[model samples]
Target chain A: MAINKIVASVEEAVADVHDGAVILVGGFGNIWNAPSYLLTAISKLPVKNLTVVSNSGGFGIEIWGGVFGVHEHDVEVLHRTKQCTKHIVSAPTNPLVVNTLETRYRAGEVEVEMCAQGTLAERVRAGRAGLGGILTPTGVGIPEIQRDKPVIEIDDRKYLVEKAIKGDFALIRAHKADRWGNLVYKGTSRTFNATMAGAARVTIAEVDEIVELGELDPEAIVTPGIYVNRVVLRQ
Target chain B: MTEKFRIDDQTMALRVAKEFKDGDVVNLGIGVPTLASNFIPGDREVIFHAENGVLGYGNICTAGEGSYDLLNAGGQPVEPRPGMSILDHAESFCVIRGGWLDWTVLGGLQVSEKGDLANWMVPEKKIGTIGGAMDLAFGAKKVIVVMPHNTKNGGYKIVKECTYPITGFRCVDLVVTDIAVIEVTPEGMVLKEVAPTWTPEEVQQLTEPRLIIAPDLHEIELA
Candidate 1:
């Protein structure tokens, strides 16, 4: 049988997500790179107590209104609707405005595990590559970040051991994808989307355009179809 | 005392920009450090790296210009430059953690005499984001911190030790503030230059740690 990973709708794409699922939402805190449709579908679901791993906690849809002139939802929708209970993130708070994650965290409504940005990326990559963990120099000597984590010395330098983080679902945004789910991204939109492509049990891609198989240049594919489980088109 | 002469943010950034050498791969953290990209010497070639997967980007775009997809570390839209390459977050940080960056200019809340940097969080809030600061602070070949010399209420930011959570240990090489330019050295924090009309003694008054005045201490020069 031929492989067909395309899903019918955004809601159907996320239908099997259970309560307390771990989700990896891709984006660098901007609408351009965010899987807004997928996140919105998840937000409308009754799923609760979710774990979200992303770069930023999100600036909410309202924050992007000034730039895009259209209010588009981001990962913040998950926090705003109270679907996510825990967030593993690098940058959680915006310096200019107090986002939903900050408000929820301050009020003790949610939990946050802060990791360095590079360390977060490596952790996700480790999950995809099936590594046990990564020894990084990022949080070494910082008491807050180091807090009880094992430290290993190599070549006369101290490194911290950070465990891998694998998610049950990865919601990613890409510029284009083929029927086989071969992906290509544009500009900086590739940030965490490409990194989290295969770092989950189910990797769902929300692309701006879908093309026929063999349409995507063989040499230019950023993500192979084998890493992706499903593809959805933007509405 | 009369209002002490202090340079503006742009001038401080210009002074910091003068430190960039030709062919330097530099990363600019958010805020004032982001302004350094606008002031790099015209004759020099400096590649700007953003933590959000863009490298060799040109400058912050004006209103109604540039794509939202192309942004700096500050999330501001930027112009695409020739020879620009976009990578995923993993490879973008590989460039950072692999020690490919020559210099990284970051904003600081407090910098210790030992070059400890604490800029990510405010202790009073009990919640702050680390972002990519830790890796940038530890991974860059040299780290430069740029901020005002003191807090809004006249509190010392350049201190003997950081009270807030630190971003990295012994990583800062230079600090450019509105009132002075100080270099971190084995001996201590060295007061290299002061804002025009401001004395080293005046700068030290706002700093928590005692400064070792440079032998050739002079007024800050932007040109």
Candidate 2:
């Protein structure tokens, strides 16, 4: 069967994003990371009220990396750049995300949802499946009030039945994708991208290489074409 | 069981620390439980375990001592006392999982009259999780809860049935709150004492699910 997926440019893929949209951006720190080109599009888009879900805005060579004191320019712009009000950070709490989201939250620009590190990953899984909520007992009643909301009860035992979370779009960076939209994430980049694919309504993948459909092995496909909505190539 | 009184969080922590005889391994859950370490009296040979791969932790460290990767369950930088050993996450989990913890001090959002606990997660919070609270609750030889007697809204944390999620059922052995110190017995939450500032009736009113106070219960004083 001919692949229904077509390769589009980066901008064309994310152009439809509107203000106050929730977007899941997958990647961790200065290791195998997501494509900056996509993040650039996100930043350039300036979509307000965005809930940016990510592991880390890594420093170093990472699009989110900056060694504690690496810059020589008396003025800083990278970490200093503030996200717009519409950006909401929904993911595990980490230093990088804290710094990024803190700037926004403290500025009263965005909202933060701190999910347990493991639970945060599972949330994408739950979100994509369209489940009511996943029961894991991540938070029963740690705080009386968390961020001005009550952690309500469900069954006899307390569990934070996190509502199934879905996103407006996902900006995924994979190592390669076949023209059919079958894709594979190389090493660490696979971190949250594969899971994000399941949860996002519209997934925009920026692949390093795009090959013919059958050129890739069937077993190698981490994300099936059915889940994928669009594909684009970096080079 | 030994009984004592405390005027505030610091006093409560100190009074609980006095219960340690010697050479006991303990795990302190996040928040209020973390304070117990600071209140421990002079050298009595106590070791602390952290769920995130740390053992024999010291009190919260001051800056300029040395930069350390050691952290409590809350992920905040903590000072590992004089003789501390660092292990991997899984091994540390084993310490808790193996029931090696002699005692554990935990904070509770709500404690039912049945001794059920709800402290790890709250509603609508993306707190990211109930870290190691369950493990410590079930694994420790003695589970001690330290919290306020009543919530700010005047609702009792001690209830007939937990309105929040249950961390462990009939697992808590002792509950030490700002109001009074009580123990869980088959008969129910046996009221050990009433806070010095309040009367038994006041404590009873603050508590839902009527409490079973010990007959000889007298007000407790901190050591």
Best by TM-score: 1
lDDT of 1 by residue, B48-71 (tens): 999999888887888789998898
Question: CAPRI band of model 1?
Answer: high
Each prediction's RMSD to truth: 1.2, 11.2
User: What C-alpha lDDT values do all the predictions have?
Assistant: 0.91, 0.63
Cα displacement (angstroms), candidate 2, residue A231, comes to 31
Query: What is the Cα-based TM-score of model 1?
Result: 0.98
What DockQ does candidate 1 have relative to the true complex?
A: 0.91
Query: For residue A97, what is the lDDT in candidate 1?
Result: 82
Tens-digit lDDT track of model 2 for A9-83:
778777888876777765432233455556666566655555666544333332324533322211011223444
What digit string (tens of lDDT, one per residue) describes model 1 on residues A15-44? 999999999999888888899999989999
RMSD of 1: 1.2
For each candidate, the DockQ is 0.91, 0.06
